[model samples]
Target: MKKWREYERLVSALTAEEYDKEYTVIPNARIKGFISQRKRQLDVLVEYRFNSDLNRRIIFDAKDRKRPVDIKEVEAFEGLMKDVGARRGFLICSNGYTKSALRRAQEHIVIKLLSSDQIDDISIGSWDMCRSDSCGDGLIMWDLTPGIIIDGTVYIQATGKCDSCGKFHIWCWSCGNRICIDYESELQCSCKGPWFWLTSIEPDCDEIGEQYESHYLILVLGNGNYHIMDRRPI
Candidate 1:
């Protein structure tokens, strides 16, 4: 349990430090009063800072328990919310909470019950380029393998087939690579380089880890470079 709490603290500290441009997080802060005179040590303290005038405390309690938390646990967390004047309180438990506990939290707008599974799903991963034409330069082809490292980052690629066009597409699990299957047949890509054609995409989400897949349209926009365009997923 101590090790789990330490891990949670480490994760919280890393996240806060990484996103310091957007938020201000204070882990393990000791406070007194507001309701009780005893000093309360918060597991992780966070503040959502958007602008000069927008900021509020978001408190967290990391519990490394394996049993389902009961309604009484929810009530206790709510008490801390009222005492600390925090707009939100996250009770992150490892084994999840009971239905009655969730029902109890419904009455408190600031109280939220989150299991480790749910918290782990909270990711800030973003696409490099959302627009098809704005992908720009810095394009490179991958060997199409699980846990492939590009620029020192791990990436996983998967394949998919469109039902309407019967074309296969590839989706990278890490870097989000779009698979292409429009083999130019008798014509060349005009880039004067090897085709580097990609084929064989799987559809199952369990395969690629992403629900979306797209078709790529490779173009040669001068300078001996290839621009990959995509019909992205919505």
Candidate 2:
């Protein structure tokens, strides 16, 4: 599929730009698995240095399909991550993913489930102060302005980790309803809005150099758990 190859290239370009020159980003990489001792084809591969000069690898797989990625594919990706011995793996889909796949991703902390619609050139700004009572001076790192539609209502979302405590913060750009969580958890606005899941991938490169975050918005559906909609990044 030529279209799928183009989509994978776009994903590789976006990921490479995210890290800039700090890391080595390779497109269409074939890596040898430790356990299988076989070369596995990856859509994108990232190599970076961790603390104490330890080298770490990150892999990305782009899925282009008419329907959302299912739970079985997510499980296979997890196995690939382990086989490749990557510190983190990003599974980016053109459509979205099912609710069961999202739940499966939560079980593994290293697997990042993402929706690759388009790469946005968002300006990084402090949208609001941290809500943590203990850390009053800390600010939310980046402001994501894309609005997610739910139940015929458009709600702008802003989510980032606190600078001091590293707690994940989710906020509504319209009503200022926000909440802080320990990690990527489903959130509901106090304004009685619908529940939604926000997935973020922040590579552990803060100490070594620059760090970038990739976020995905998953819309909760009332029909069934077989399908879930993800916001298209603008």
Candidate 3:
């Protein structure tokens, strides 16, 4: 597992280097499954806005096996793609793929197979500063994805745990705006548009029937201001 972790790290670094600007590349992303309504752990999830009304989501899975990946593995991954409603999926393998696997991947338009050779060397460095005012110069590891739309514009947002203070650091990727929820709970865009924070609680049960909270942030733009609402299940 340690070796696999290293391989995944390499893929994540390369992916972030290539797609961080235009797309939100999240490593070790945990997303809820639309079908099962359960949390599914993904190796990486890439999110972007195709247009004003459409959001495109892509998933990446890394396999580090000695032998080539076979058709069964490809099929299993395809199921995951459907469960998550991903537009497309990339399966990165260290040892390549079997002929059957290649054929199966070809059969599915959403599936793409890649060898580790496809990813080049990348230097993973800290990109943004933590928004925490007290935690000066604290670096925030961003996992930005598509957030609320405001006035015909889609805003990319990320919230990372501050390394210095262990507080949530929020940021806007499009305009270099940053805020720390520990010190401040309000969010505003770079356009000087104020964003209101709202919360909603929803009750939910896990796969084992254990109750949990579901959280979502809804952003609405009107009257030259933006409203952000969070749905948290209790």
Candidate 4:
């Protein structure tokens, strides 16, 4: 379980540079434009921007397997690397790899295997490397300026009016979830899952614009997750 949490941080580490540079990459999701047309799910998908668009890509996959990885797995990953046409690929694992697996991975230099001990070698441009070194520190108090609420429970939220884009940003700290609003008043989770009681009628665009939207009503979704949406009316 901790490994998965760490894996998520690693995904953040892998994509943080692109994010800081204002390039977008999908996380914990499979990319669609690749060769197999959805053959695999990438933990981190880094897109390189050029000419004001994403033109090239790099990828990373974290395998938290209980047993040591095998050469067959490495071979499969190599094939995927070729199929995706990724500029570089890294396979970070919880356990070590087999000798044959290591040799097989090297046969395809694009894909390299990293044992648990080597994770510290990962280079992150912006996030303090020491922050991610601790799962609790890396996850619990993200510096995203989430609004915290306390009642029968403690929650986090980002619900309010957006000034420039002019939309509602919402969040729930207790559930550790938030909303990502785009054009119009339409909103969805970063996971892009169905909006389950995800939106409220009261906040109406006007209420958000007025900054009078009720916080308690907006923090907790029907699914019991926190929704953090930025409400800056510029």
Candidate 5:
């Protein structure tokens, strides 16, 4: 399993009825890539489309870790949403937020901090009616299975140590460039430039089929069906 799949699983376990009555969960909802003036690629752009009666959209960026989400990250997400013409945005992380980050988040956008326990609460199936886009039929479905697809790219900060070189490397799957920790180590590849086809799964859908959750970080590649490139717990 890839880290991204685990993110999906974690989100799949949330209870859908307690949240907004008209929140619909869409995993990996595509945000137009070319809209940005600088043309920056975004990771994990999930869309929460409200009921048809309410004409509004909520966007989210999920990070599966215990570290404090920095302001720069929030700024980047905000930029992406603004570029795509979205009015509201959220940053979801497995851990919590820093006091400074939380304060900063409140100043600009609607940010929600979720812990593993809260995530469990939503998964307990003890909420009200889910008003997301997919709840109209009264049939809710929770998606826990991992499904990998191609044609998606990711930008990752190098966090793991290389066994062969005994050094840290930052690899950007979107650009296919691997750099050293200090931005000094430069390794060039001749095969496919710096880009690598990464594989990851979309978040899981709640039983109500109203919301989707993020569980892990993943990379997507190719055009056909995709597969996980790294093994991690889900």
Candidate 6:
């Protein structure tokens, strides 16, 4: 576990430019606070900005345990992505993903599975060279809802408002669910209907009347307010 943390730290050190040029790291990354679901807190939340011309963003839920990634875990990550306005999402686990879990992730987001052996091979020197030098004194409360994560090589996710419905949505191509934003409560959608909470608005990357792309659009609603987040490029 310590080694995996070291690898993550090292990966975080590489700049977006360095990552793009060498495939070594992503940029503008940040560790997410504990995600509150119902009454529980998740393991880890990470966001990154990918070094792409389209400004791709991604978000992930990481667990440093030896157990296989599960379906519920992926669902939680999907919910988080919609809340944060991310285009893609991932579930990073220490032991790798299960076959069923992988299939489910493919339905909603891109999933990356890493073995303990693979974690051992990465170099740790990059982290030591890029440590931050300054610290400010204050209890900073960052709205994880609007921050991003860049893991040195790609954008984990981006948080913002949807272009069409002007609402915040989390677009997960894998789960086929679009999460709607609910500001009053952290919950993206509270609708009791199964698909009602999982539907999305029109995509922003292509013409509206033309063929719809294979991306999930999320519509967030709560406290009589509404908004949307389009996760597709076209």
By TM-score, rank the candidates, best first. 3, 2, 4, 1, 5, 6
Question: Which candidate would rank higher by lDDT, 1 or 3?
Answer: 3
lDDT over C-alpha atoms for residue 12 of model 2: 64
What are the per-residue Cα lDDT tens digits for candidate 6 across 60-84? 4556666878878777777776544
**Candidate 1 TM-score versus the reference:** 0.42
* Per-residue lDDT over 23-78 for candidate 1, one digit per residue giving the tens place of the 0 to 100 score: 44444555443567555676665544322111255677777777877789888888
Off by more than 4 A, model 4: 1-6, 14-25, 50-56, 107-179, 183-234
Q: Best lDDT goes to which candidate?
A: 2
Candidate 3 vs candidate 4: the lDDT winner is: 3
| Candidate 2 lDDT trough over 10 residues, lowest sum | 225-234
Q: Model 5, 1-234: lDDT tens per residue?
A: 355433543453242233342343443444343254343332232233211211144456667776878777777777777665455666777776676666667644665666666654444232122222323312123222223333353333222222112122334443554433321222333344333333233444333333322222223333333332221111
Task: List candidate 3 stretches off by more than 4 Å.
Answer: 20-22, 49-55, 107-120, 125-140, 143-184, 187-234
Distance (Å) between predicted and true CA of 63, model 2?
Answer: 0.2
Report the number of the highest-TM-score candidate: 3
Full-model lDDT for every candidate: 0.46, 0.57, 0.57, 0.45, 0.40, 0.38
The segments of candidate 6 whose C-alpha lies over 4 angstroms from its true place after superposition are 10-55, 129-234
Residue-level lDDT tens digits of model 4 in 1-234: 356656555554544543533233434534343355654556655543211112244566777777877878777777766665565666766777788877777733333445556556763333321122212332221224333444445343433322112233345343555443333343445554323323333331231122112111133354577543321111
lDDT of 2 at 197: 53
TM-score, structure 6 vs. true: 0.41
lDDT computed for candidate 4: 0.45
Query: How far does residue 108 in candidate 4 sit from its true spot (Å)?
Result: 4.7
> What is the TM-score (0 to 1) of candidate 2?
0.46
Q: Which stretches of candidate 2 lie over 4 Å from their true place?
A: 49-55, 107-234
Please tell me which model should have the higher TM-score, number 1 or number 2.
2
Residue 54 local lDDT, model 5:
14
Per-residue error (Å), model 2, residue 132: 56
TM-score, one value per model: 0.42, 0.46, 0.55, 0.44, 0.41, 0.41
Candidate 3 per-residue lDDT over residues 1-234, each given as its tens digit: 255655665566666666744454555666567677887777766654121111356778888778778889889898888877776788888777877788888644333444555534433355456665677644444555456676677666665544334344556566676765543334445565435432233444444334444333434355555333322121
Which of 3 and 6 is the better model by lDDT? 3
Residue 189 of model 5, lDDT score: 32
